[model samples]
Target: MKLPVLVLCLVATAAAAPLALAQTPIDPLDARDVRRLDKMEQVVRELRAIVFQGRDIGKPVVVQPAETDYQLQEVSRRLADLEQTITRMTGDLENANRQAELAKRDAEALRTENRSLSDRIASLESRALAETVAPPGGLGGASSGLSANDLFSEARQALTSGDYAAAESGFREYVDAYGDSSKAAEARYWLGKALTARGAHADAAGSYIAAIRGWPSTSWAPDAVVELSRSLIALKKPADACQTLAEFAKRYPKASTTVKTRAAQARNQAKCAA
Candidate 1:
């Protein structure tokens, strides 16, 4: 049967591909092609002689048909899916960058807030350390921001923490600021203790005496006597030390056992008269 000119033309096009495909066969032939390699090669050569050369050689090559519409549509669908996947990945990358930027800003804000709070705490501590002198103008006054007890406690903490200078400063501030306050006697007593610890026994004696004179009936009174006697001894005033201890019991009739015991020790050491 004679093939139409168009059919023959299609065969000729495939026929021309063999030499080009042989030298550089970029695409791999199909499985069916593997089974017919020799037959396809021989037919291609024959069709090249008859159609493209316009001379009869052997039988012609029966070229395979192009892809059907369904195959082409399936390929288009797969390409579209690949494009959609790439678009989604790009959007996800952008979102991740935005989230990272927001997290960085939040961390920076937290650091700034922490710094501000730390500075405020340091300022409060500095205010607490200022010397307690006055035009009656210190923290012990009612107009003062710090309460008498609060001011006193900070000094006590300094003593507990072994910051003798700060303790002395804080206690003086307490006494000058709130001399009439309930905590005043205790503050003065501790001030003396702080001074004595730092070898300022003369100054310490004055604080103990102030405790004894101003708040004599307070719990610190007998203790003040005990501490005052010690400070006096340190000042090389043994007679005054004996006298202070002698007055301890008469001054604090209901003194604590601790205070009584301490007084007895001081008295014996000073060889005071019973």
Candidate 2:
């Protein structure tokens, strides 16, 4: 009876797999889950040989043999183990899906900002061109009246194109020239990314910390939280990394899906418990 009950549970879970797929992210069954299912299949085969073939289909299979009861207990234990693992895995999948959605939204936001910055840059250049016609050095000066958003977007483009040094310089200049600009927080965050890309984790952590402290309310601040943790990890400061991640949820109560996911992962990397 216990053997049939266990097999039925396994079959029920298999039937519900499609619903899980719809609710969770892409991977419904990880390697451990696959291995556990394989083990369940083998257990079912053993039960079929031991008790299923000789039993009446609708009757309660009360096994009299002590050895058969032991087998039943073992199968039941395995089933319970598999069930618990599946529960945890489902939670992880859902979290991953949320992160993916957040990343998609973030990308769209970046595209929109880029377009807006480009329009402003065009307008600024037009005015600069008119001014340059009257004086040869009018628009050529470093003080040529470009907005912070325009300069930040250009530096971001260079970063996207893998020009780390150019990106770093541009970001630094923006931070220095427009420290009070709405985009300065993001610029500091990207400066950290640029520095980290060049194997300067120590310097990168400083920029990331600045991003967090200077623009804690900005959208990029949450991302800076995760990046700061990662930079600490690179500096062989696992405890500090874990500490930074520990405060993530509290600091950024409304962090994006991806930022939350990355925070969890960074905590794991730091070997944080609970």
Candidate 3:
């Protein structure tokens, strides 16, 4: 009897377990929970699609946020601006370098021209000196035997004969030997004329300056001043030439018509003010 009772109890417990489970209340999901589940489902679908696409294409998967495209665009714009700035700076630097090179070349050209001019002047001076020594037993070689008056006469004769080299040597000797003599100024004037004929304008200017010292009262004084002005003009010193001419009218009021005419010509050459 106990065995039948135990079998019936076991069957009743088994049927009541199902009834208890059927009576339990299940809580439905809220709106927030439903939205969260939907978002998770969409993300899972996208990830699966990306994985499948990457496997098919044999390329790596790259998942970017929504703002990443905008950030990349901003970085690209900044890089473009930087590239433009670098291009402008490079152009400016190249222009500066080109200008500096041009300036350096110009300076070198000017230096070369100046050196050539100096060499030409020195060659002319050497030629003049060589000519002075060329004549056999000429004024310079035989000058020791001649008296001062003889030397002056020979130099004047050489000048009149257009023998400029002998004249220069003789006159140079006369001035050196008799600088304190009465004809010293005249000798210097003649020396300046010979130097001028040889295109030695710088040396001629010095000789003329020495000849016109103290503004002597001789007849040649006005002519010396005019010749000095001419030499100054040759030296590209127009201002100094004009200044020398200005003193001519005041210093030599009794200047000859020939000298006055020469002075007028020099004034025109120098473009002196009236």
Worst 10 residues of 3 by lDDT: 128-137
Best by lDDT: 3
Ranking 2 against 3 by lDDT, winner: 3
List residue ranges in candidate 2 displaced over 4 A.
1-145
- RMSD of model 1, in Å? 22.8
Per-model TM-score on C-alpha atoms: 0.46, 0.46, 0.50
**Full candidate order by TM-score, most accurate first:** 3, 2, 1
lDDT of 3: 0.79
Model 2, span 56-170: residue lDDT tens:
5645655454588889999999999999999999999999999999999999997886566445434433443343211122111236666667778777988999998878877
Error of 2 at 220 (Å): 1.3
Q: At residue 31, what lDDT does model 2 achieve?
A: 93
Give the per-residue lDDT of model 1 (tens digit) for 52-99: 433354454465655788898999999999999999999999999999
The C-alpha local distance difference test score for the whole of candidate 1 amounts to: 0.72
Ordering by lDDT:
3, 2, 1
